[model samples]
Target: MATSGRREVARRILRLTDGIEESHEVHEPVFDIKDTPIESLENAVNPLVPFLPDIRKHAVTAKKACKNPPPDGLTLDESASIRLYSMEWVPHDKCLYVVLNDTLRSEDGEKVKPWFLYLKLFRTAFERLPKQHLTELENYQRAVDIGMHSLPSNHPNFQQWKKALESAKEN
Candidate 1:
């Protein structure tokens, strides 16, 4: 994998695991114009193409994690499948928090664990978002636009989330 790809995978893993006792070496961003031409950069940074590989890896890992029975000797229901229940956008974080239905349960009928999926809004596959989510994004952007324009310059909330939203939208 390219350095960017590796970084993306590491990022997803860290997010999923909440960085519990995890450490990753940080590397300076590289922009090798010579090695990676401008066209390649354009393609690499394309929102649709940039995150497919990372998302695929995440899907596979999540599948395996959910499919296997828990170590506590609990058996998963054969008919159970992970299902997305709802998604909420966190404008401050520039990410979507996906809540999923329980896909596994103990033999005693207790829920095993709940899965939380985080999808970073910037530099990611927007197609992963449902039409309703896209509408939510539009609604949020409109609300921010209105707030930025209507709020007084010196108001504490003025331009608070505008900058972050603009930055994320750029990606």
Candidate 2:
């Protein structure tokens, strides 16, 4: 988990949740599938054993909280899971978000390690997004690409953006 990866995860989390509280301490260790060790769990580090379960727990909690939580009493874990889950129901992305949330909440300094795994999971999940969602995602991606481009020239993909912007402006 290099520093850049950790920051990417943070950026994605913010993009998915619109600025919610997140953890950056979940332990993520790579495993050799060929090696079978019963005690391997003991060596896990991202968020610790107890926090690993938080992903599922928070996911369920997020679903419930979406409909009926106090203004500021519930943890973002649940809400985050619910929204991400709703987006596509792709387990991999949801898993990344869950684990990432766990990492963000963690304090042990193992946050960067899970970056690759989380990104992999995100790709898997993103692949499952619906057609309608793909359009929306493309719109967002195009906006980001244009905003980040280094060249002085205007972005070539401006028609779709203009349509989207005009639609938004009309509303």
Best by lDDT: 2
lDDT of each: 0.32, 0.42
The best candidate by TM-score is 2
Worst 10 residues of 1 by lDDT: 77-86
Candidate 1, residues 28-93, lDDT tens digits: the string is 432212232222211222332232324333333333554455332222211011211121133312
**CA lDDT for candidate 2:** 0.42
The segments of candidate 1 whose C-alpha lies over 4 angstroms from its true place after superposition are 1-139, 144-150
- The local distance difference test score of model 1 is 0.32
